[model samples]
Target: MKMFLCFFVLFILGFDDSSSQGNVNKAIKILTKQVKKLQESNKANFEATNMKIETLKNESQTNVKSLDEKITNQYETKVLKLENLIEQTNLTKMDVNSLFGEITNQTEFLLKAMDYKLGILKVGNAECSQYNILNEADRGISSGDGDNCDSTGLNTSPMWKGASWYRFLPPAGTILSQAAPGEDHCGTWLSGWCNATLPTVPGSTLDIEICFDYSGFQCWIAYDGKVTNCGTYFVYYLDNIRDCTVNLRYCGAN
Candidate 1:
């Protein structure tokens, strides 16, 4: 009887041990499956993120290229127009002034576009000075009778008060002259003129005259011309009868 009881106790303990081992094996298998699934999910997410980043980078590059191309084309078109205008021979003084004004505007546009494309900073404008109220007896030329702007022979007050005359001297080493009309009055017109003395042994001088009609309220420019070696002296005149404004640019070493 003692032998049988010992045998039974041993059998019971062995069975419990076997059952526990089976449960542990099943749990391990489930955990392994979960870990593999998690790894696959993480890898897929990483690859998708990388793809999105690459796509955005390519799009950004394409957009920048397109913008640069557009700006370049526009600048080229403006340059061609200017060249054609300059090549014309039958241009009047008024036509020249208009061309100068157009050149100024186009140059500004080109500079800005170049700044954007090349990542370069633009230079500031050159220094300038203005002179008003000329001596009639010395510098005034009779606009002849019936000329409202210059006929008075005496410079009036500022343009806000009425008609006036002004002189502008650009900085030394100026390469171009710009003279344009200013304000508008009833049945009145704007006029511009320029005189530049070259820095040569003979010291030749160039004179330009321009006239604009104000019948329909559109302002006109009288004259525009180039001034090389304006290092000695340059003088531009305007009838500021609400008809002229002054600015000097492109001044540097000859």
Candidate 2:
């Protein structure tokens, strides 16, 4: 009878152990399923984060390109504006030059002749360089030594520091006559004498031009703005005649 009781108790204990083990195994399977679900959720969130980062990177690159395009367009617009301004400035300069050239032509066309002797040109203490003298050798001209230009006016002297004197004529531009400081000159008793011709045509005008060199003492003459004659260099002696002035003669003598 004891052996039978012992076997029943042992069977009861074994079945209890087996049922506990089964419950433990079910609990473990449930916990494992929950862990796998959480892992999958984490993986999905990571992928989403990566996708957001990629989108932001692409957006940043596009923004940069757009900004660069805007800047380039602005720069090009400014450059075009500057070019237009430069063109306008050049046009203005050309117009000013044209106006100045016209005024110069009018002034030269209406130039008047001046006689340096008989106090005719000596209105004040002004120098001879102010007036362009017109003289003819056939007509009488008084002459003497230094500063003695004529007997009429003792102070009416010109810049005659050089040895040779030149007198130009109009129509066919030529040195009609030349003189030196002596009594034996072509014109008698003349500090400077020249046989000059007067323009016969009524509308013809005497035109003279001076082309100055960079050196202070040298200049050249041009007839009617044309350099046709050679050896017309005007050299200053004692640094006296350094200025470039037009000296033209049309009606020279009586």
Candidate 3:
């Protein structure tokens, strides 16, 4: 009976130890699986974060490229517009210069025509052989019948007509002397003789001096025999002979 009881006690202690070992093994297996699941979750989170960072970088690069292109296109458009403006300005300057050249040539020709008419007036007055002098001894002198007069008598004084004298005088003022060409004051040409064929140019004045504030100011001749101011120049037409009024058109801004 004592041997049986000892054997039964030993069997009970062995069974308890085996049961504890089995429980420990089962707990270890469950803990290992939980750890594996946690590791997989962490790895998935890291991959998602990396993908988000790569997407942000790509968006930033695309935005930078778009901005650069817009800026380049605006700069190019501005440069092209500036170039076109410069070309147009240059063309306008050339056209103004060409028109001014034609005007100068016409003014010179008109001045020459006036000089030729003056010489004829002086010679015709000198050849008159009969004259009537008041308050002189030889009062009534005749070229054909004269005693002690060597076939030639003093010439009669020539009378100037109103129309002929008006040509020589400045726009205002009386004629102080006989009408003559190439005779002017202040370097202007005067009309001494009137010819119907050579009518004065309409809207043009003679014997007027045109001065400028700058050196490159140009003057041109119109279809009429008058000088016209050209370019970006200030023109002053002075008439010292009289208080003459002038109506002028503005060529450029004052």
Candidate 4:
């Protein structure tokens, strides 16, 4: 603005006369210097503004990435916590059942151990109709006599001539029909257990089905109309004759 006013003053003076010609020339030089300075100042300001804009843009991008990562981590954490909670709930249910078994029938539990199959029996006294594998060795009560049971030891039959405690352990699978008398046979309760979490309602006995297919080693353990455990551990194992049984039973709930 000052340059414009000075140029106007110089024009007015020059129009007055050639007598002030020297002063007019000096004014022109000063105007030229001011214009050059103004151009340099504008160039510097433009560069500075562009740098600020670029910096702001970079900061915005970084903030967006950070926020996205934070949100993703939070989501994963929540999912893991929910999974852990569900697992704990299932474990607690089993714990409660075992606790009741301990309090109500210690001997029965000792005989049954971790057996899954039940003898759908007409019992004298029991909370549910289905009962774990209890036989002449334990109580002389079973679903089928010797065909599905190993009652030879207790004087029921000549016996298949094998062993006991096979169905009383973790896998409660029965391979008696498929296997021989003594070698890990599928006796009656259906053997081949797969890696499956047993779905259960809290504070109740788990009436879940666990089946293991040794062919391809696929296992399905389910309860409450949902499949729980399905993996390598429970489904397929033949290396140690301990877990190489065909645990096939009713496909799904009837």
Better of 1 and 2 by lDDT: 1
Q: Per-residue error at 230 for model 2, in Å?
A: 37
Candidate 4 has a TM-score of 0.34
C-alpha displacement of 152 in model 2, angstroms?
A: 25
For each candidate in turn, the TM-score is 0.28, 0.33, 0.34, 0.34
Clashing pairs in 1: 181-243, 182-243, 182-244, 183-242, 183-243, 210-222, 211-222
Against the hidden true structure, what lDDT does model 3 obtain?
A: 0.34
Least accurate stretch of 10 residues (summed lDDT) in model 4?
Answer: 228-237
Q: Give the TM-score of candidate 1.
A: 0.28
Worst 10 residues of 1 by lDDT: 245-254
Q: What is the lDDT of residue 227 in candidate 3?
A: 22
**Clash count per candidate:** 7, 1, 1, 23
Candidate 2 C-alpha lDDT tens digits along 171-192? 2123332322233222222222
lDDT of 1 by residue, 71-103 (tens): 999999999988887766446667889999999
Best by lDDT: 1
Question: How many residue pairs clash in model 2?
Answer: 1
* lDDT at residue 168 of model 3 (Cα atoms): 18
